[model samples]
Target: MDVKRISGLGRNAAGDLAKGVRQVGPGGQVIVVRPANSNFTLQEYQNFVNNFKPQQPGVTFRVVDEAALPK
Candidate 1:
């Protein structure tokens, strides 16, 4: 599976970016970087994940704090 990292983007923008990536038809994980000032809400994130579930069963998307990423 492919792994993608998306940072510095709001909810809508991040969703757009993820959708673009999904067009490639690769099932993978999308890691959204959640900063202190991020406007990405938990509900929005869940909706984003759920929205793609029906279309692409292999795709998995989630949000995480920037610090949680491995060096």
Candidate 2:
């Protein structure tokens, strides 16, 4: 699977998300890996995904907590 990884989410996250979506192209996945100490909340991440869904169809946007990743 084609994946675009992004570290943390901030005020300028949308731009990065857009770039990631474009980089991965259609049907690709953009994974935003949030750091443990990130100031952004899960709700914010979800909001970003929700907002982008309509704008970019076929592109998968996901936010994963860094702590949840397998070591």
lDDT of each: 0.55, 0.69
TM-score, candidate 2, is 0.73
Residue 58 in model 1: shift from native, Å? 1.0
The 10 consecutive residues of candidate 1 with the worst lDDT sum are 1-10
lDDT of 2 by residue, 1-71 (tens): 23434455544666777787777877878887767786777777777666764245688877778788899
- Model 2 C-alpha lDDT versus the unseen true structure: 0.69
**Residue 41 Cα positional deviation in candidate 1, in Å, after optimal superposition:** 4.0
Give lDDT: candidate 1, residue 12.
Answer: 62
Candidate 1: where is the Cα deviation over 4 Å? 1-11, 14-17, 42-44, 53-55
Models 1 onward score TM values of 0.45, 0.73
Q: What TM-score would candidate 1 get against the native?
A: 0.45
What residue runs in model 2 are displaced by over 4 Å at the alpha carbon?
Answer: 1-11, 53-56
List, residue by residue over 1-71, the lDDT tens digit for candidate 1. 33434444456655665664576466756655555455766556556555553255566666666556677
